[model samples]
Target: MHPVCEVPAPGESLAEVGGVNVHAGPAIDGRDRRRLERLCRYVARPPVAQERLELTPERQRLVYRFKHAWRDGTHAVVLHPHDLIAHFDYRKSKLGMAGR
Candidate 1:
């Protein structure tokens, strides 16, 4: 699977929890779709940023950061569950999925 791209901040609402741009909808290519799916698994909660600094204790330091969903939220989602299971089941069924 390809690495997921960093989504633009202003475009947050425009993109679904899975990073599927609403405009692109369900028509996304397989690679992006897989990335979206991976993203979706982590969307139950808000994302948090983590910072890391790399250096040799020298003159310059490189900073890196990334977003991730909180473990509490993920645990909650798993514990409480949701209709997503049924939704996926129906989606794979003859009735076809509702809502892109």
Candidate 2:
């Protein structure tokens, strides 16, 4: 599947992608239904919880790895689907720059 270009805003239950309006309620038939189905499938799917932490961005790649346990410690990083999509887009631009 092709990557989605525009990411919807937070708390946005409905949106229009590639000229197709996706919302709740009854489903229509034909191409519109198919488009809506695709949209629902993509959005309904949960985001990948796994994320790589980068320590450096240079000729030599570096990633941060942690392995420790505390008596009562907690860590959390909240990320929305749009954030991940934007990150990928940013990386693509960086890659293009690296080639130059």
Candidate 3:
């Protein structure tokens, strides 16, 4: 987690009830492979999507939008430039198996 990372509960988008996020949203459907794949995709997605993040006109602040709005109607967030990069995630394989 970033120093200022405050990811909201995913309840707004996936849960039947608004704002009720639990640790694990399970998907165990043996009959529907497609549905099960969709469920897994959400948890596997990166915390931030490139298109979802942008800098202000002056390039001072960072604005990030959620793919789906929260139940309370909040759709985006604003942050300082440094904060945006503080916890940015990247991958580099030391075992030489990354691009193979």
Candidate 4:
């Protein structure tokens, strides 16, 4: 089965995990729903961010780095886990469709 969310590119692995249900769209199964819930809980943990990098101070840009979550030399773009969850969850859906 195809994922509800679009496959992420290199340097965007976090979104890959967080966007799973979103990409899976209408095809999401019970297992996927459960996994998404677990993932949302996991990301709620306080110790998730192992480091922080300033991408651009002028633009107030920063990225939280999760060392355990990334492979060596690969970039993992960070977005708020809740935001990802909301994007995929029905709670934030206006028309009850997955929010891309």
Per-model CA lDDT versus the true structure: 0.41, 0.50, 0.64, 0.49
Ranked by TM-score, the better of candidates 1 and 2 is 2
Candidate 2 vs candidate 3: the TM-score winner is: 3
Clashes of 2: 0
Model 3 — which ten-residue stretch has the worst lDDT? 12-21
Comparing 1 with 4 on TM-score, the higher-scoring candidate is 4
Q: What are the clashing pairs of model 2?
A: none
Model 1, 1-100: lDDT tens digits are: 2225555664343334333334333344567878778667655543322233223245343332223446654312211113434645565453443455
Distance (Å) between predicted and true CA of 56, model 3? 0.8
1 or 3, greater by lDDT: 3
Clashes of each: 0, 0, 0, 9
**Per-residue lDDT of model 2, residues 1-100, tens digit only:** 3323344554445655444455544445667977878867877775442344442445243342334434455343334545656776776575563222
Q: Which residue pairs collide, candidate 4?
A: 3-23, 3-24, 4-22, 4-23, 4-24, 4-25, 5-22, 5-23, 5-24
- Candidate 1, which segments miss by more than 4 Å at Cα? 1-80, 95-100
What's the CA error at residue 70 for candidate 1, in Å? 25
Candidate 2 positional error at 16, Å: 39
Residue 32 local lDDT, model 3: 92
Q: Comparing 3 and 4 by TM-score, which wins? A: 3
For each of the candidates, the C-alpha root-mean-square deviation to the true structure, in angstroms, is: 17.2, 15.0, 12.8, 13.0
